[model samples]
Target: MTELPFATTRKLGLVIDLDTCVGCHACVVSCKGWNTENYGVPLSDQDPFGATPSGTFLNRVHSYEVQPDHGAAQLIHFPKSCLHCEDAPCVTVCPTGASYKRAEDGIVLVNEEACIGCSLCAWACPYGARELDQAAGVMKKCTLCVDRIYNENLPEEDRVPACVRTCPSGARHFGDLGDAESDVSVLVAKRGGFDLMPEQGTKPVNKYLPPRLKDVAPQIDILAPFLEPVSKGPKGFLGWLDRALSALPGEDR
Candidate 1:
């Protein structure tokens, strides 16, 4: 079985804003495209064109219609991936030492070469973040796009995770959560970001910003005065036409 490090030098994770996500699945598509092409193995599909198509994906979005106590129902788009917990149960449960967390940066990853296709990690994960690749017969989860973020060939701006880069609504943010002054940390502090399922004690690195409640009836209502009319009557070409029409017989002045 694998053992987690006592501490990591940095905690790199995502801060997702629930209020801005539009459930467009751009993140999902980008993740699939990047991971399949560059990562360990291509994510496979079974019966893609058939009635029941199933495939491996590293990121997925779930939408829930939630009704606040005082407001109308709202649809929340939730994107789910590996949380890379500080005390990752998936790591401790791995029998072959394939699943491990990085000591330099707290990113959980699976060593595909060492993996024996055991489903233990998937079972241990509470977030349902792991998926067994049907073609490869190995468990796969999100790596936080480690290859892209640290690659020197890619442009600086493109160093973020594919999901973060492709998010149309700017809902996904990636940074060092460990740093108190980091942008992600500041956003989390300002938005009251929270862990998913805190009771699990996994100490997930990723934080989610809660959706701000929609405004109900206004407590005070004040109407603005109507704007004065711009002109009392037509004053240009329309004025000349009006004068000509008024001079004609039987024309109302």
Candidate 2:
């Protein structure tokens, strides 16, 4: 039997549920911790206590307020990171072959040794996934926890990315998206998943399941037991005088 290419056999990806995410940043903290300790270089912060503090991070959670003209406001917390695209622009734009997609698992990675500190790859990426590691003088991004995911010494269940494992709300999922029978594929199919910035045509593997809406009644019962009544405190001397004056004939209060 002809062997399938390694990339096709193992296309690792993430499936994010927008509906379940509560905007908590546990995943972000987990990613920072894992990547800083285990990956090529640390994600560092500059002037931590200063007025305009800045830091380098592989993952960032963006909170977007989505409001409809007729409905209540909806908060969408989108955790942005490397999508590890099948056709990654960052790889192509790299002057050196420092940025390349892995043939074994389709994970895009950077060879820091070969990188020349040029920011071309960052520009190529429309998703703002790449960040410059000033300390190492190279571009950095999410490795999908490459070191941990493939460690033979680690337990099988703990082999997943730190972000995926640490998510409190179960909003993050990691699996082989290429496989039709994978849980991610099933979730995407069932939840009507969508890709962000499709116009860029990066063909990002990560899928985002849109938030589901709750049903609301057209009219509310103001006098319902569950509803609190508005407090009407006694009026002051001005109010008493106004009422007394209003009781007078032809008085307009």
Candidate 3:
């Protein structure tokens, strides 16, 4: 097993807003486009024009339906990626010293030259953040765009992760989570950002802001006026049921 240093000076990561994420996979596409050329692996695609096309991606977005007892169901767009944990199992479980965390910025990185494609890191990661690049025969993951973030040639404003730059909804934020005064930290504190699967003990650097509260009055209005039906509308139990079901949460689904 591998081991990490005692601590790091900074924890660099992302803050995702569940409320603002519009289920756009721009982050995923931007990540695939940038890291394929900038980083270690090529992020190869298995079958471009075939029936089943799959590729190694560092980012993914998932949509889910949430049904609350008092309010309408909401369709949540969740974006996921490497959390760059404080105690990363993906690093410690590696038989080879290919995986390591940076002390300067706390970014988890894999050196393809040293990796043996053992797949141990993939199994060790609870978030499924690592992907095996068959062409390179190595495990790959998000580098927090170490090359781009620290690049001298690129403009300072363009130094952020590709996903952050391409996000149309401004749902993603990148900053040093270690600094309480940082913009990302302030947003987390204000929005009550939380970790993913906290019980696993990874202490993920990336945090997710929960969806904000919404008004449920219109949803509850279905039962108004003693469930009375208008002269022009359908009557009785069927009318009540129709209104109730129509006003149910996640109506767009």
Candidate 4:
């Protein structure tokens, strides 16, 4: 079995905003594209065009209809991936020592070369983040775009994970969570970010912001009554014309 490091230099992770996520699945597509093209092995698809399509994906989004105590039902888009927990159960449960958490960045990863496709890591993960690539016959999960993040050849702004870079809604943020003053940390603090499952004792580095409640009732304009016409009858010119018509033949005053 593998053992976790005592500590890590930095807790690099993501901050996702549930209020802003639109369930577009851009992150999923980008993750699949980048990993298949550049990462360890290409993700496989079985009967992709046929009825029953099955494939390996590192990231997935789930939607739910939640009804708050005092508000209407709200559709929530939740994106799930590896959390890179400080106490990663997947690492310790690996019989072949293939799954390990990085001591430098706290990023949990699988050594595909050493993986035996036992699916122990997948079973140990509480978030269901790991997947076995049928083509490579190896376990695969999100690496936080390790290749892109540390590559000196890539531009500075493009160093973030493909999911973060491709999120059109700006719902994803990545940085060192260990720091008290990093942008991602501050955002988490300001937005009251929370862990996916605190009871599991994984101490996941990633945080998620709760969706802001939608207003239950529309706002009433205070000046609406004042904007109404003072009189229901015709105005000055029309009143005169009415009086004149009333005085004509067969007209009543």
Better of 2 and 3 by TM-score: 3
lDDT of each residue in 131-190, candidate 4, tens digit only? 999888999999999999999999999999999999999999999999999999999999
Give lDDT tens digits, candidate 3, residues 1-253.
2578678899999999999999989999999999999888699988878999988999999999999886678999999999999989899988889999988889999989999999999999999999998778899899998888889899998999999989999999999999999999999999999999999999999999999998555465655868645577767998998788889787555
True-vs-predicted CA distance for residue 243, candidate 1, Å: 39
TM-score of 4: 0.86
| Model 3 steric clash pairs | 73-249
Q: Which ten residues in a row have the lowest lDDT in candidate 2?
A: 1-10
Output the worst ten-in-a-row residue range by lDDT, candidate 4: 213-222
What does candidate 1's lDDT look like per residue over 210-233, in tens digits? 998677787553543455667899
Clashing residue pairs, backbone N/CA/C < 3 A, model 2: none
**Candidate 2: Cα lDDT at 111:** 89
Q: Residues 120-225, candidate 2: write the lDDT tens digits.
A: 9899899999999877788989999999898999999889998899998999999988888999999999999898899998888889999987678767666587
